[model samples]
Target: MRATFMFRAGDVRVQNTPDPVLRYPTDAIVRVVRACICGSDLHPYHSLPETPGGTTMGHEFIGVVEEVGADVATVKKGDFVIAPFAVSDGTCEYCREGLHTSCEHGGFWNDTELGTGGGQAEAVRVPLADGTLVKVPGAVDESLYSGLLSLSDVYGTGWHAAVRAGVTAGDSVAVIGDGAVGLLAVLSAKQLGAEQIVLMGRHRVRTDLGREFGATEVVAERGEEGIARVRELTGGRGVRRVLEAVGHLPAYEQAVGIVRPGGVISRVGVPQYRDAEIGWPFFGKNTTLTGGPAPVRAYIEQLMPAVLDGTVQPGRVFDREIGLDDVPDGYRAMDERTALKVMVKP
Candidate 1:
């Protein structure tokens, strides 16, 4: 099998790797059908000093099961499933309480430990298969590829951010990034009944998709200018809910600063902080802050129906498509802000 690997910061390559095999009774091996490059992957791709060299890259994928362990009853050979980025045992205390991401047996598919290679490979080993894999309802189609692939990360994550922010009917919400996750946050907010959505992005293509996904306003400014514009749009009160999708310090600060005094700031960005700071102004504002690695498993079932029925098309965020060999180019394009999201066909 050929898998994508990040040998060092700013380096991504597709090279031959050994095929994945079932390592646990709850595991299943799947042939990768569709996979994607995520924005979070950029953190290490750009500046993580300790990012291990020669590690398989990628974490989002949709695929068909080629084999399953004896204990994996929910999925079997030939079933098309959505592999959530996190593998969790459904029976864990945390999983039972809806915190699947924190399950005692939960883990991520990475280069270390029980590595199943990367989603950007020809096949992947999915642990806790019964709990982490969701079968696509009915038939799969070309139009459904992106949506199915989204179930692995972005769509579920964006929905989690919206839910954590407490977006409600008639409330105004602001999304802090224009990537696939941010655009889907706009869609999720809309589905949650928000009356107004303000997308903070400068790209016309992304902003345009934001509107189509239910964003009522698009603010192209950044830093103080962006915050001022958001305040101006909200009658100086700022929005009630702020969704932080970019993990950088500036974006984090912007999310905290743009919300009203009693607003909620729900962040889904994988913070790349060595020594993160939250000043006095944040505490003085009395705003509620919440967010972390999204427990995507908890929301997959809730969001799947919408995707299957055409009520929401989170897949619209995919702006470009490339083959597995072009993944390095995809990363470069996204890093340069030349693409919103890249869907890779293996």
Candidate 2:
């Protein structure tokens, strides 16, 4: 099989690799149909150290079941499934509480001995299929691929951010970031009934999409200026809910600065910073901070119906599509900010 491998920073390739097989009774082999290059993948693509064993790429994927292990009764051969980025046993205590990302037996793709569940490959070994794989009930077509793929990560993560912020009907919210997840967060905010949603993003294309996704305003400013712009738009009251979708200290700082007293800052960005002085800013505002790796599995079922019925179209976040072989090019485009989101057809 041909799979994507990251040898080091700035080096990504699609080359021959061993095909995955059902290694455990709880595992299922999936023939990847649609996969995506997430914004967070840029973290390692630009900073990862050299490793003899190249890492497999991609975490968002939807595929057809080519084979299933003996104990995989939740799905069978020929079933199309949506596999979340994280692999987990469905029956874990944490999973029951809808925190699959923290499940005792959970792990992310490409971080395990089975060489991660390389979704960028032609096929992948999906563990805990019953818990991690959600069957796609909608028709399989190019039109639906983007929405289905979003269920695997970006959309779910954005949804988590909105939920954690407790976005309610008629609430004013500001989303920080114009990336795919951020754009999707804008869309999710609308679905949750936010009356005024402000999106902070610099890219014209992305901010334009953010408007289409229901963002009432787009602030192209940054840092203190950005917060001032948001405050101005909200009549100096600041927003009740602020979403920190950019995984950096500055983005977090802006989030803390703009949230009104007693508001919440829900962050779903893969936080990279180690420490911060949250005592003064966040606490002084009486803010409630929430969010982490989205338990996508928990929300897939909750959001699938909307995708199937066309109530929401978060799929608009993906702007480029390519084949598995063109994945390296996709990476370059995203790494250089030339594309919003890159989807791969294997």
How would you encode candidate 1's per-residue C-alpha lDDT over 186-244 as one tens digit per residue?
99999999998999998899889999999999999999999999999999988899999
| CA displacement after TM-score superposition, residue 74 of candidate 1 (Å) | 0.6
Q: Output the worst ten-in-a-row residue range by lDDT, candidate 2.
A: 110-119
Q: Which runs in model 1 stand beyond 4 Å of their true positions?
A: 48-53, 274-279
Cand. 2 TM to true fold: 0.98
Clashing pairs in 1: none
For 220-275, candidate 2 gives per-residue lDDT tens digits of: 99999998999999999899999889899999999888999999999999898988
TM-score result, candidate 1 = 0.96
**For residue 10, what is the lDDT in candidate 1?**
88
* TM of each candidate vs. truth: 0.96, 0.98
Off by over 4 Å in 2: 113-115
Say which candidate scores most in lDDT: 2
lDDT against the true structure, per candidate, is 0.88, 0.90
